[model samples]
Target: MSNMLLTVEQAAEELKVHPKTVLRYIREGRLQATRIGKAYRIDRAKLDAFAGVASGRTRPPHGVRATVIVEIPALTTEAAERMATFLGAAALGGDAETRPLHFNTAFDPTSGDLKIVLVAAPSDAARLLELIELQLGLSR
Candidate 1:
């Protein structure tokens, strides 16, 4: 019985809610708990069920959305700058009013790999890729 029971404070911590909220749930019959003397004891299973419901652990409303992380190899400072400008332009075309997309550029002289990471919406991902291909002469 002790193992299956949790105190109000413990349940509140597990649920990430205030102790008062737990008490309110108990009073409102939202949570199934027992009054032991002056303390409230909640069943572990019931607490878990309530947590799943309150946290909306159900399936996503719609289908899953995909995010693409495009990486471009930049060999020189000029190439890196060009990649940055291309990504900036794509982000502007996609959503200029909103926050700009994130762009990361790193040059490894030893490896001779200039890396650029562009994080943007799926719709804008193709434009960015096309720009990189055009810059690198990879596309005919």
Candidate 2:
């Protein structure tokens, strides 16, 4: 993570607001900052979040990300639990420097429907897809 710190004045300039406004945001918890000996230091990423802009910190340069939603028409509870465990383990085993993977699952017991949402790098997504296919005995 970049330790880039911006002073209140710098943050205000980037935000196109007054310095006091930035301070007010800090007070209101709208913006996150660190107080160092009476001076507030704001993170560029935090500022970007407050401004409703995408931070460069999220996506690495030249990197490809994938968002995949997989739906299983029918799955047993035990099978779904096993799949979830396997996917979660894979997500947790990703490289430390790489962007973290987001995995979510929803299941309907009555309908035997299982839905999985995965946000990860392209390679990781492919790996997870392969695992899912293998678990489901589906070729492709």
Q: Work out the TM-score per prediction.
A: 0.42, 0.55
**Residue 59 error for model 1, in Å?**
18
For model 1, how does the per-residue alpha-carbon lDDT over 55-138 read when each residue is reduced to its tens digit? 233544662333555455436666666665655445434311232344566767656576666665444556667777887889
Q: What is the C-alpha lDDT profile of model 2 across 62-123, one tens digit per residue?
A: 76779999999888999888787777666655433556667789989998899999987788
TM-score of candidate 2 against the unseen true structure: 0.55
Model 1 stretches with alpha carbons more than 4 Å out: 1-74, 95-100
Alpha-carbon error at 95 in model 1, in Å? 4.3
**For residue 76, what is the lDDT in candidate 2?**
93
Q: Which candidate should be chosen as best, given TM-score against the real structure?
A: 2
Clash pairs (backbone) in predicted model 1: 74-114
